[model samples]
Target: MNVELSFMLKKMLSVALMPWSIAILLSLLALFFLYRHKIQKAKKYLTISILWVILISWAPFANLALKPLESSYERLENIPENIEYILLLGGDRNNRAWEALRLYHKIPNVKIITSGHSLHDPISDAEKTATKLIESGIPEERVLMQAMAKTTFEEAQHMKERVGEKPFILITAAYHMPRAMKLFKKAGLNPIAAPADFNRPEETGYATVLQSKQLKNTERAWHEYLGILFYKLQGKI
Candidate 1:
């Protein structure tokens, strides 16, 4: 029971990360100040207002932070010689999932695994990914789904139970790969990372990359940065 409670905390902590940004942070502090002199009702209203924005942007914030982490797995070099299974992580987009499925089609006798959970994400993450892979002419038998996992740690742990004695390739965003790999390692699964969906730097100037969108990107990067730290503290990785 303590373990399950801790897992839930980590999951919620991942979403709460967006509000840790300066934009939301300052807004929260300002509201706290504004409520200091106000009635209880005013304090409640302000609290509600802040929570709403935080919830609304959680997904986008996650998406933003994940950009670079998503890119870390991208390999310009040709495929290495010994991969036997490919594991794709789930998110808003199936970018890595599609890539893994494609690789499955190209390779010989390799299997694909999709790990996900139906939590805040309404769409079935692992199942949706598996559906696509099966549609692509890869035999249904070659795909494995670990649908019960909601966190990166559980995803890797559960995947190991399903996949044994195969050279596995784990696909996820580059920034996320670091933490995911750590979790996979802790789970006793050795997986080579395959990252996708990079948030690239501008060749011309840093200014272009520092636009509002980029600031948002940094907010997301900060989230992943902080998230990894917390995971480390908890030994979740």
Candidate 2:
């Protein structure tokens, strides 16, 4: 499949898999069943649909679902010796760039590769992040911006082309690390997972259970799960 087409498809898939989209879809399906006079089936579907929305929106349930993905790999206490590059994937999230900066501070000689494509925005994510890194005291010479990759699979491919077989730390959100690792490996790059942007709650309580952030977290978790499945189906990982 063409790269642009794949990127668009993945974006569409992400929107469709979001919590609100899934809830709306389920509710619509329930209505259809009801119209067909399958009362029991309609009731079952409606009940599940409502509960699914509520649970995903609820903080406790969302956190529970996200915990496994966030904890899939532990954070590195010390940068391993001889790592040449720190590969940061592109997203609106700032934690990824912060993580890259942290690694750069630890390994001052390591090159940084910020990869992301220009979607609807005039500035590519890579360039945006690269600028931030430079402003944060990273020398411009040490930062490389790869502005052609719009997805994790593309990021792996581009990184491999730029630094073939060289060891690099792959930095992304904690929930996204698993899929990122698989794609990087498939692209034949040596990636050391450097997950960041952990969304885990520090404590659990009655008030925490009703927070709106849970809905967003659940949506993010679902996005990763769906991305993994789609990538597997496409043989990208």
Candidate 3:
């Protein structure tokens, strides 16, 4: 599939699979059934919808879902030898860039590859991140931008072409590391997972059950799960 189309499909699926979206959709269906005078079915659907909303809104539920993905790869305490490049996948740009720069300081000789396409901005994410690295005193020549890639699969493909058969540290959100590693490996690149931007959740309690942050975290976890499934179906990983 075309990269842009795949991205769009992923976005659509994300919204569709989100806890809020699914709840609202189910509620709408319940209402539709009620309008048609199917009272029993309407009540059943409404019950299911409410239960789902409650289940996903709970902090523990979301935390349980996200924990595995976030913990899929632990942070590397020591940067390994012969790592020729540091590939940073785009998400939270500034944080990822900062992490990339920190890695650069540890291994000043390795090239840094920032990958992302433009979204709602004239400056592509890769270019913007590369500029940030340069501004931080890293030589401009050491930063490579793969601004054409809009998704993890595309990022893997582009990086494979640029750093073929070379081992590199793969940097991305901690929750995103698993899928990124799978795609990069499938693309025939040797990737050392270097997950960053870790957001450890607070202890789960009754007060956190309906918190907006928990809801957002649920959405993030669901997005990664959906992305992994999509990649599997497409044979990209």
Candidate 4:
């Protein structure tokens, strides 16, 4: 299969397999069964859908799915003495951009490289992130934008061209760091993981609270898990 086509297929499959997508698909199937007067099957599908949503949204289950990924690398501390760049991978633009900014404060000499492409929006994520960094008082020249790469593997490929053998801080979500590190290393670039957008809280309560936040965390972790598997099969990591 062509690489771009394969990437799109994987994305579609991942979106279809997300928790909310599964729940919605099940609900739709239940309605179809009801229209056919198969009341028992309808009830079974509906019940399973409800249970699936509840299970995914419960805090304990979300924590269980997320801890392994988020804990793969501890938050980066002790910036290296003379790093030249901070490579901010694209996702959750605000928090990740803020993280790059904070790191810039600590190491003012390092340039920030924002990497991502536009998806449904006119401006690319890389440009948006770079604009945020510049608005936060970082000089325009200090922020670079590589807006063509749409996936982590592509980002690593671009970084290889831009900064091969240079030890740079890599900024991305905490849960995504493990996969990101592997991809960058595969591309033969030196990336120091600086994970941001942490999903797990310090204190998770002992109750199964049904909330969207927990569901979001579960979805994020699920995506990373799927991404790792997909990349492994494709020999990207």
Candidate 3 lDDT by residue in tens digits, 1-237: 986786788788778877799999999999999999999999999999988888888989888888999988888768888777998888445377777877888985889988788767898888878888888899988988888877888888888888898888999999989998999899999999888877687687866666777787888888888888988998888
TM-scores vs. true structure, each candidate: 0.72, 0.87, 0.91, 0.90
Candidate 2 regions exceeding 4 Å error are 30-45, 205-210
Candidate 1: worst 10 consecutive residues by lDDT? 202-211
Off by over 4 Å in 1: 1-8, 19-22, 31-78, 91-94, 120-123, 203-212
User: Measured by C-alpha RMSD in angstroms, how accurate is candidate 1?
Assistant: 6.1
- Tens-digit lDDT track of model 2 for 1-237: 987787788688789878888888889889999999999889988998888877877777787779889999888666789888888887437557888887888985899988878868898888888888899998999999888867778788888888899888988889999989999999998889988988875556545544577888888888888988988998888
Q: Which residue pairs show backbone clashes in model 4?
A: none
**lDDT winner between candidates 2 and 4:** 4
Q: After best superposition, candidate 2 residue 167: deviation in angstroms?
A: 0.8
Query: Distance (Å) between predicted and true CA of 46, model 4?
Result: 1.4
- Candidate 1, residue 81: Cα displacement in angstroms equals 4.0
Clash list (residue pairs), candidate 2: none
Query: TM-score: which candidate is best?
Result: 3
Q: What does candidate 1's lDDT look like per residue over 100-210, in tens digits?
A: 765776678887877778856676788887887778777899888778876777787677777664557877766677777887887788777777656664333322322
Q: Identify the leading candidate in terms of lDDT.
A: 4
TM-score of model 3 (CA atoms): 0.91
Ranked by lDDT from best down, the candidates are 4, 3, 2, 1
The reply for model 3, stretches above 4 Å from the true place, is: 1-6
Look at candidate 4 and tell me the lDDT of residue 54.
88
Steric clash pairs (candidate 3): none
- Give the better candidate number (1 or 4) by TM-score: 4
Every candidate's lDDT: 0.67, 0.83, 0.84, 0.87
